[model samples]
Structure formats: structure tokens, C-alpha cells
Target: MCLKRGRTLLQYAISPAVWLGVWQLASMAVGMDLLLPSPMAVAASLWKLAGTPQFWLSALFTLGRVCQGVLGGVALGSALALLTHFTVWGERIFAPAIRVMRATPVVSFILLVYLWVDRATIPAVVAGLMVLPILWGNLTVGLESVDRQLLELARAYRFGRWKTLRLIYLPSLRTHFASGLLNAFGLAWKSGVAAEVICPPALAIGSRIQQAKVALETPELFAWTLVIVALSLGLEGILRRVVHPREERGQ
Candidate 1:
């Protein structure tokens, strides 16, 4: 077990070392900080940012936007899914809207939504809009895929709506729900960041990245990019911990 764990750790370390070596070589070859900063320069910039209160506040604001979008999107999407799943009229009304949301460009939404909301809130709103269609589609598929025989049996057994949902639909939704959330988090972050970049929020990672670009702070920009990547990976880790165990058991 110890050997296996050590090997796993070594593999993890080795890949990054290899990539960093390549990056350093490329940066050295370029010989311009403006174009491609070395790993050391980027790391130094990241350290400098880490020591600032501004960085923390920006991270916090972006984190809130991400959470707000993801949670609201999931709730709204699931509700719409339930409505559409149960009634033909519900499907008729919502299906086209959901499809439209999915098909629309994120930039288009950002431009249109900017007219309705302020810059600070636009990231959250855009993130939510990106998530809604994903959850709605997954849920629609999940609900529709539920066993009709089991549904019939539940009805014949005089099970009420709530009971039927609790027993049948919820269980059926497990995989789809987890899948939606895991996928939605990434979508939410990307859309949120894109909105921030376009709108330039007061305090956000995206705002920092945009400023870094405007200033031609390549190392700082790379460092900020790394921060976003790290956050995404961390969120994925948390979701995996929460969702994977249940999936394994279901299997």
C-alpha cells in the first residue's frame, strides 16, 4: 500500500516537473517576459498576489458569484424539469425556451443581459443562465428515462404524487443529477469569468485577469489563470468526493 501510494505521488509530481521544464525552456527561448514568462516569474507574481487583501476580496466575490449561479441554476432547472416531466402543457411551454437557452451564444447572452443587470451581478446571472439549460436537459432525460412499469405500479398501488416522486423519480434522477452538477460547475465558472472579463466587475478574478491583460502583465495573467485552474480543480475534487461514492454504491 505504501509503495502504491508513493508511486502515485511520484507520478503526479513527475508530470508537472516535465511540463514545467518544457515551459521554462520555451520561456527562455522567447527571452521576453511580455510574451511568455518563466514559471519562476509567474510563481513570484502569484506569491505577491497571495500576500494582498485585494486578492482575497476578489476571490471571495468570484466564489460567491460561482455559488450563486450554480445553486440557483440547479434549483430553477430542476423545478422546470419537474413541471415539464409531469404535464404536456408544461413541456410545451418550457421545452422551446430551454432549447433556446442551450443554443444561444454566451456572448450574446452577456450583451443582452448587460442591458438588464449591473456588472457586479452579471457574472452570477450569466453563470446561472449557462447552468440552467444543462440541468434542465439532464433532468428531462432522467425523468423521461424512469421505468414506466414502476410508475404504473406506483399509481396502481395508490401512491400519491409526492410518494411517487420520492420513491421513483428521485432515485432515477441520481445519476443525472450528479452529472448535471459536476458538469454545471465548470460551465458556471467559465460563463461567470467570461461575463466578468466582458463587464469588468469591481472585485473578481476575471477582473484581475482582464486588468493584467490590459497592463500587459503576462506573468500576472498566467498566475491568475493558474489560480482559476486551481479553483476549478478544487471544486471538481469536492464534487467528486460528494458524488462519486454514491455513484459507486449505485453501481
Candidate 2:
């Protein structure tokens, strides 16, 4: 087990090392910071940015918006899933709209939403829109796939609605719920950031990225990009730990 664990760690470390080497080589070949800033230069810019209050504020604001969108989406999606799955009328009314939302481009939503809402709210709204359909789909499938036998057993045992939900439905839907959350969070974070790039809230990572681009600050741009990547990975890792705590510990 120890050897396998060590090998896994080594593999993880080696991939990054290889990629960094390739990136450095590519930057050297380019011979232009504007076109392809070196990793070291980007790292320096990141370090500089880290010292600023604005960097922290931007990260915090963006994180809050993404989280807000994810929570809102989850709540609404769960409600709609329940409605549509249980009622013919609800399905007829809402299913097609959910499908349309799933099919629509994120940019289109951002642009259309931009006209109706405050600039700062666009990222959260877009993020919520991105998450809603995903959650609705996953939960709808979960509802459909639930073991009918267990439900019959619950009925035979005279289980109350709340009791059945707590003992049977919740456990049955755990995997689907966890996966949906993970998928929705990733989409929400990405869409929210993209929305911010398009609409540029006053204090956000995407706004900083936009500013860096407009200023032609390639190293800073790369640095900000690195920040986004790091945050995404870090947050996803945390989410994985939360959703699969037992599996994470076993690993």
C-alpha cells in the first residue's frame, strides 16, 4: 500500500514537472514575454499580486458569487425536479424549458442577462443558469432510477413520507446528489468567471484578467490565469473531499 501510494504521488509530481519543462522550453523558443511569458516571470507577477489587498478581494468576491449561484441553482433545480417528476402538468410546462436552458450557450445567457440585471449580478445569474439544468437532469434521473422495491417495502412497513425520505430516498440519491453537486459547481465556477470576463464586476478575478489583457500585461495575465486554475483545482479538491469523505480517507 505504501509503495502504491508513493508511486501515485510520484506520478502526480512528475506530470507537473514535465509540463513545466515543456512550458519553459516553449517560452524560450518564443523569445517574447508578450507572446509567451516564462513560468518564472508569471510566478513573479503572481507573487507581486499576492501582496495586494485587491487580489484577495477579487478572489473573495468571485468565490462568493460562484457559491451563491451554485446554492441557488441546487435549490431551484431540486424543487423543479420534484415538481416535474411527480406531476404531468409540471413536466409538460417545465421540461422543455429546462432542455432549452441546457442547450443554450453560456455567452448568450450572459449577454441577454446583461441587459436586464446589474453588472455585478450577471456572473451569479449566469452561473445559476448554467447549474440549474445540470442539477435538474441529474436529480430527475436519480428519481427515476430509485429502487421501486425499496419504496414498496417502505409502503409495506407503513413508513411515513418523512421517514421514507430520510431512511430510503436520501441514501439512494446520495451518489447522484454528490455527483450532481460536483458537476454543477465546476460549471457554475467556470460560467461565473466567464460572465465576469464579459460583464466585468468591479472586484473580481475575471475583471482583473480583463484589465491585464487590455493593458497588454502578458505576465500578469498568465499569473491571473494561474490563480484561476489553482482556485478551480483547490476548490474541486475540497468539494471531492466533502462529497466523498470516506473514499478520500480510504485512498
Candidate 3:
């Protein structure tokens, strides 16, 4: 098991090393930091930024906004799924609106929402909008796909509503909900950052990214982008661990 784990870690390391080597070669050939900063230069910029209080503050604010949006979206979407699944009137009233939301471009929502909301709030609102349709669609399907036999069995056993949900519905929807949540989180994080970039919130990673770009600080831009990527990966890893702790522990 140790040998296998070591090999897996080595494989992961090799892929990044190879990509970094290619990036370094390309940067050297270009010979212009403006067009493409070297990996080392970006790393140095990241180290510098990491020492600043503003960097941590911006990351914290962005993380808070994205997480708020994700949780709100999940709650709203789950409620909508339940409503639409259980009632024809709910389906008729909300389904078309959800479809329209799903069809609309994210940039459009961000722009429209920006006009309606304060700049600082736009990121969270836009992130929720982006996540809502995805979760709603995924969970609606999950509800539809619940095993009729299991539901009937629960009814046959005279299970209460709470018992039915706890034993039958939740277990059946677990995979679908988990998948939708992870996907929604990724979308929410990205959309929130994009909204922040467009609106330029007071203290956000996206704001810093925009500042770096406006100043033509290419290395700084790369560093901020690397920070975003790292944060996204780290948060997603945490979510996965929470969602599938048994799998993570090799159970």
C-alpha cells in the first residue's frame, strides 16, 4: 500500500514538473516577462504577496462570498426541486423561469445584477445565480430517479414522513446531491471571481487581479491567478473529503 501511494504521489509530481519545465522553456524563448513570466518569477511574486496582510484579507473576503453563494444556491435549489417535484402548480410557475435562467449567459446576469446591487454584493449574488440552475436541474432529476420500490416499501412499513426521508430518500439522493454540490461549488467560485473582476469589489482577490492587470504587472497577475487556482483546488479537495470521507480513508 505504501509503495502504491508513493507511486501515485510521484505520478502527480511528474505531471506538474513536466508542465512547469515546458512553461519555463517557453518563457525563456519569449524573453519578455510582459508576455509570459517564468515560473520562478511568478513564484517569487506569490511569495511576496503571501507576506502581505492585504492578500490574506482579499482571499478571506472572496472565500466568504463564494461559500455564502454556494450554500444559498444549494438551499434554494433543493427547496425548488422539492416544490416542483411535489406540485404541478409549482412546476408550472417556476420551471420556465428556471429554464430561462439556465439558458441566459452568466455575463448577462453579472452585468444586470451589477446594475441592481452594490458592487461588493455582486459577486455573491452572481455566484448564486450561476449555481441555482445547475443544482435545481440536477436535484430535480435526482428526485425523479428515486426508486419507486423503496418508496413503496417505506409506505408498506407505515414509515412516517421523517423516517421515509431519512432511510429512503436521502440515501438514494446522496450521490446526485454530492455531485451537484461539487459542480455547483466550482461554478460559484469562478462566477464570483468573474463578478468581482467586472465590478471591482473593495477587497477581493479578483480586485487585486484587476489591479495587477491594469498596472501591467504580468508576474503579479500570474501570481494572483496561481493563488486563485490553488484556492479553488484546496477548497474542492476539502469538499471532496467532506463528501466522501470513507473513500478518502480507503474504506
Give the per-residue Cα lDDT of candidate 1 at 77: 96
lDDT of 2 by residue, 1-251 (tens): 99999999998999899999999999999999999999999999999999999999999999999989988999999899988988999999999999999999999999999999999999999989988999899889988998999999999999998898889877877898889999988889999999999999999999999999999999999998888889999999999999999999997
- The best-first sequence of candidates by lDDT reads 2, 1, 3
**TM-score of predicted model 3?**
0.95
Best of the two (1, 3) by lDDT: 1
Summing lDDT over every window of 10 consecutive residues in candidate 3, give the lowest-scoring window: 164-173
Clashes of 3: 0
Model 1, 182: alpha-carbon shift in Å? 0.8
lDDT of 3 by residue, 1-251 (tens): 99999999999999899999999999999999999999999999999999999999999999999888888888888899889998999999999999999899889999999889899999999888878888899888888999999989988999998898889878878888888888989989999999999899999999999999999999999999998999999999999999888888994
* Model 1, span 1-251: residue lDDT tens: 99999999999999899999999999999999999999999999999999999999998899899899888999999999999988999999999999999999999999999999988989999999999999999999999899999999998999998999999999999999989989988989989988998998889998999999999999999999999999989988888779788664684
Error of model 3, residue 215, in angstroms = 0.3
Candidate 3 Cα lDDT to native? 0.92
lDDT of 1 at 162: 92
Model 1 residue 88 CA deviation (Å) reads: 1.6
TM-score of each: 0.96, 0.96, 0.95
